[model samples]
Target: MDSNDGFDAATKMETPLKEYFDASTWARIHASLQGSLTKRGAGNEGTRQFLDLVLLKAESGIPWSDLPLSHSKIHNVYVRFCRWTDDGVWPPVLEAMSEAPEAQRLLEQLVRNHMIFRRSRKFRSEILKAS
Candidate 1:
């Protein structure tokens, strides 16, 4: 069997989130998230990398540990994500970005996938504990 096993080339070639949005659209989304990012003390490039890592995770349905090393540390990104969720920063940012249809669709998919992944992980942990 090939080293890639069950994975397809497209999975390996996953594009960065920034490429999906034009410069103007990205600027809008970035602007929308700027306050939260700044409050977290994340610089522009770091914030972009963090967002890209998140989108990649959502799209790939991969475990946090499986995230590429080239991106920010997985633990840091995951913690930031949880903090954003707890602080309710995502909804308003997502709402603001929804003005762009493509961005809206992609963000919706990311949200849905992330939710499903979280539920499944919780269920699996519960099953393990029960067993």
Candidate 2:
């Protein structure tokens, strides 16, 4: 599949897929991610674009290296994915987006199956600060 397989400007400019997330949901995710991850560099691809690419990757269940250049560099996407996973950045975002019953069920399954982490001191501190 092309890197931009499911996420192109034309597609985004039109209606977004409600099954995944809407534009406002993406905006919240992007803002939260940026605020939480300070070292995130401002890539040419904006947070929305990056998120679109990530969603595409997740939905397609493809290897990170398979991401197309039209999205972002595979290396960058992989690095961000790792960082986000390690930093416990995704659970909250998923929780916030789980408004629909389907989304909530999916989030529940994901957490039930794969959500396990020992909180680092730094991670705890960040959570406290956010509170």
Candidate 3:
């Protein structure tokens, strides 16, 4: 696989959130979170990366040393996840993994997976199931 395959112009612009994600990643995200809220605005780059980080952390079960947060990206992502999953976002960020059809299709093709939630609202860890 090409490590550079998913890199886009946005990833090279000091986009702390965008570095770990791409358009294809966005699509799967949309589909995965279909009914839930906090989807994301049409061109909100930061939110896109933020959402990507959330999913990545949720799936990888790894230590978050590369996110743009002081403590840990996983903590931030869990907070956001509970926020979105609970009452949902006020304006709704267009976050479902299927929000973008093209990205949805490609990402879905690349990945087929689900998450295992912890006992509490806060996630202890996340594991990614292979396609």
Candidate 4:
């Protein structure tokens, strides 16, 4: 019996999520976002993880409650996202990211998701007021 089994480098595949950005592109994104997302004692790694989860939600259009547990708690992520939106943090970041060819598609998806979210909230509010 050989120590090495069926693992084959050639057969390895990356998930669709991982295909979004290569190392270099991701680094550029991280650099661009660092100023806004940085927290004392927490390094760039945390921002990277948080951004990954945000991107996942934006790309999938899934409800926050449906996010995977491995990524932080749904409430925490949602709250942070809302806070950022209300604080006007995303506009500049998205604008800067739009200039990068590698980030354009992802930025478009995020923008679309944000618009849909806003419209749905407005509709719900209108329905509540009419009742």
Best by TM-score: 1
Tens-place lDDT digits, model 4, residues 47-83 = 5555566777776778766666433466676776776
lDDT (10s digit) by residue, model 3, range 1-131? 67777655333223444334456755655444445443444334445666566545544544455444545444665566556544534123333443444444433322222222333323433223322
> What stretches of model 1 exceed 4 Å from their correct place?
1-18, 70-72, 99-106, 109-131
Predictions: Cα RMSD each: 6.5, 10.7, 11.6, 7.4
Worst 10-residue lDDT window, candidate 2: 10-19
Off by over 4 Å in 2: 1-20, 41-45, 70-72, 100-131
- Put down candidate 1 lDDT per residue, 1-131, tens digits, no spaces: 68757655433433444444566766777777767767676455776677677767766678777776523466788888877765767776677665566556665777666668778999999999999
Between prediction 2 and prediction 4, the one with superior lDDT is: 4
Better-scoring candidate (lDDT), 1 or 2: 1
lDDT per residue as tens, model 2, 1-131: 68856666522233342236676765565565665666766233455555556665555656556555533466676666656666777776666565534554554444333334334556888999999
Ranking by TM-score: 1, 4, 2, 3
| TM-score per candidate, chains pooled | 0.60, 0.52, 0.36, 0.56
lDDT scores for all predictions? 0.68, 0.56, 0.45, 0.62
Clashes of 1: 0
Task: Point out where model 4 deviates above 4 Å.
Answer: 1-19, 38-42, 70-72, 96-103, 106-131
**Clashing residue pairs, candidate 1?**
none
* Model 3 misplacement above 4 A: 1-44, 63-68, 72-74, 88-131
